[model samples]
Target: MSQDLQYWKQLKEKNDASAIKYFYDQYIKLLYKYGYHFCQDATLVEDCVQDLFLRLWEKRSSLGDTDNVKLYLMVSLKRSIYEKLKKNSKTTVTEEVPEDTFDVTFTMEEQIISSETDQITKDKLLECLETLSGRQKEVIYLRFYNGFTPEEVSEIMQISNQSVRNVQASALKKMRNNMDDPLLILVVGKLIESFFHEI
Candidate 1:
């Protein structure tokens, strides 16, 4: 196992407060940002995150080792968001979770774009991003931005590995329509292209 993964596993097994706090500190922002994609309420995200950590701490000793700490936490956060939303949704009959509710913003400050012309391109990219389903965007964020492998993404997304590949294929097909837009490629990075090629 990787040293870093082993370190976290040891920390969790020992119930180290610093390690627990470090996990919370390191991931809170990403978790909050990602959770907001599902539910717009900031306080709800904050509460769920806090509750997630609390439950983790409460069950730390019993938890199994994880090679990818971030992905494990991310999967937990996604579940927390969905469960909270479902409970608060208060439907008498089961209702489908809205598939298009995710929102992700790519800002110019990220330095992938630098010119006024690129600003227009950034706008176009965001417009194109909206063409994707929420799960598509989630997979893109996980696979491209965060560098998770397809198997890892399958675990975090709670889908079969085949399903992850299928979602990636579909998302890329939509993105292929904009392959001529160099600015879009630059902004999201050639990671998209590389990911597609590898798949």
Candidate 2:
């Protein structure tokens, strides 16, 4: 097994602070940023992230082992956020349209060093992203930006594999229609470049 898997094994077996801390150091920012995409509140996202880790540690003895820590944590954190939002009536925007959860915006750090072409590309990218439905944007971010598999994306989004495929197809189709460059070459390539750097 890999080092991460080893650590996860230790965590599941030991249920210790150090083991939890290791995961916290690695995943807190990712969970926070991801939760922020849905909630648009930094403090709330932070709380949800902290709570997710706390809950993980508290239930470590009961939790199953996992090789895919990122996908697991993303799935858990998303579920935790929705549960919290539902409990707090003020946080729940609507019961009927809970899947309309994304409001992702590019961060300053995510911005490319400015130039005429870069700015134009950024504008085009943001415009195309805006045209995507909230659920579609979430799927794109989870798939291309975070590098999750289609099955993992379905798990995180609580949708079927077929639904995941359909969503990806539709999102890429929209991007291809709006974009000057090929969807994967320009879109996923640029996202991959900046995404892994920060995460």
Off by over 4 Å in 2: 90-97, 107-119, 179-199
- Give per-residue CA lDDT, model 1, range 1-199, as digits (tens): 2644765776767768777777877788888888887788988998988998898888878887777888888889888887778788875437856656666764433433346544566676666666888888888777766778889889987889898889988887786576576656675445346555556
Regions more than 4 Å wrong, model 1: 1-4, 92-96, 107-123, 178-191
lDDT of 2 by residue, 1-199 (tens): 2766777877788766787888888888888888887786667778888888888888887888787888889888888777777776555455633788786764323333234446556667667778898888887677656777778888989899888878777776676677666653475445534433322
Taken over the whole model, the C-alpha lDDT of each candidate is 0.75, 0.73
Highest TM-score scorer? 1
The most accurate candidate by lDDT is: 1
Looking at candidate 1, the ten consecutive residues that score lowest on lDDT are: 106-115
Q: What is the lDDT of candidate 2?
A: 0.73
Candidate 1: C-alpha lDDT: 0.75
